[model samples]
Target: MKDTSMPELRAMCFADLNNAVKIIQAHDEDDGEAAEADYRDAGFDNQYVLEVDGNIVGVTGYRDVPGTDQCHWLSWTYLQQSSQGQGLGKGMLLELIEKLRSENARKIFVKVSDYEDPELGKIYQQALQVYQGVGFKEEVVSNDFYDEGENQIILGLYLRDDEDQLEEDPAVSEEKPIIRFDGLFEIAETDGAYTFSWIVKETKKLFGKRNFSVGDLQVGLESVKNEGGRKVFLTFPSNLPLIHSPLQTAGFKYVGQLQNYYEHGVHEYHFTHDLNDL
Candidate 1:
């Protein structure tokens, strides 16, 4: 079961370019023209956004890798501070991977920046964990992949074999059945019946026992509820049937399926769509 009110994925528009530039500048201050050029090159098919309630919370784009078996690079991805926890990043990455895989890309590469400060580097390292968790392997290290003094580590992963990395990665929160209705419905401790009942339905659909409990739908809901787009994600006890039709009827697209997300056998399905299209 998923929160019907959550926002979905949508194409990044030309109007969104200026703000997208600011988002990129926040990450890398240098080479604004190059970034803009990359966005322009992508055109309509290149970039996508994760929005909720009419705001762009996350962004990602793809580019072709010439003279290599791999066709494109998942060049950029970002989520606002408010949407940090609750698996939004993971969901976005999975969406991007699905598009790349559909093109029959043998592999996808992401080279993340590494800093000099151990503490700051740790933050990048944590981000690296997310990429690694998504099937991208740390392949090489360069003294300055972005800045003159900074370092960059090249990560690579085979699309077919590495897809499971997402499922195998450790769960972000310990809260059980982190559910949300931020996209389509309001979910709080006070109104738990709708979400709880659906969880039971999904569990029965999966043919698995209801061993897991719903902990925080608001937190989970916030992850997918973007301002301009809509995305749906459902975390269930792995053995259960994961039929999230309530999400589908609400116009969500099944983007990717993650398996073995936890040692205890929890799995998740990530879905996305646009609010206007819905």
Candidate 2:
């Protein structure tokens, strides 16, 4: 029988980390520890715990998509294994959406992994269905992103109905320019879907000598590929006109955009390259 009692959502405190971590681990032992550590380090301020009759049953939260005020990413949403199939997860999701909507969040996004194992994939499928039932749209999929067979699925929910599009500014020059890379890091990897990230350390060097070129991007892509990365993701401020063409030319597909991500008019454009296809 389903619990007739309603679950209460309350702000989670740093002290509640142990209990929350236990619940998360009970659901996913492999990734729960890392997720708990991440939440403890960076997510304490924005997270909440779901309590039913004074017992913690789940945890949920969202963080502002770095560089965006109105866009947010759903973080470490997990329910205790014992609580599965009780409809509590769906209710908690709706509550989180309502809370974000009230805060005037323009958009919310979440990443779901499609694992190689059939049983594990069903677990993610349930999660995907819950998000879809609440109007979240599938935006992009990076095949073999986690490893050899697992994939990463990005889903987004738009809180507002406004369509705000910006025109691209013309490139000043078409010549390939020298670019430098730094701070290469692995963003995340689960079930063999490895995603790598890096920074553009020296774009200023190309100011007058030449325009950002496709060759500059190819260099970075080749480096990531050499490192055995399955997918490479990069995000740049929409106002940076020179970076756009080189990205498209290097075969990076536009995954999605975060509105007002950098500022009022400037947005953050997300692009991805599938290393397997290369």
CA lDDT scores, all candidates in order: 0.54, 0.71
Q: Compare the candidates by lDDT and give the number of the best one.
A: 2
Best by TM-score: 2
| Model 2 agreement with the true structure over 178-255: per-residue lDDT tens digits | 334444556654432233344444345535434546776677667767776667777766666667777777898887
Query: Which ten contiguous residues of candidate 2 have the minimum total lDDT?
Result: 170-179
Per-model TM-score, in order, reads 0.50, 0.77
Write the residue-wise lDDT of candidate 1 on 141-246 in tens digits: 5432233455556666666655444544544344333232333432121111112224322324355443322223333334335432232323343333423544
Q: In model 2, state the lDDT of residue 83.
A: 88
Q: lDDT of candidate 2?
A: 0.71
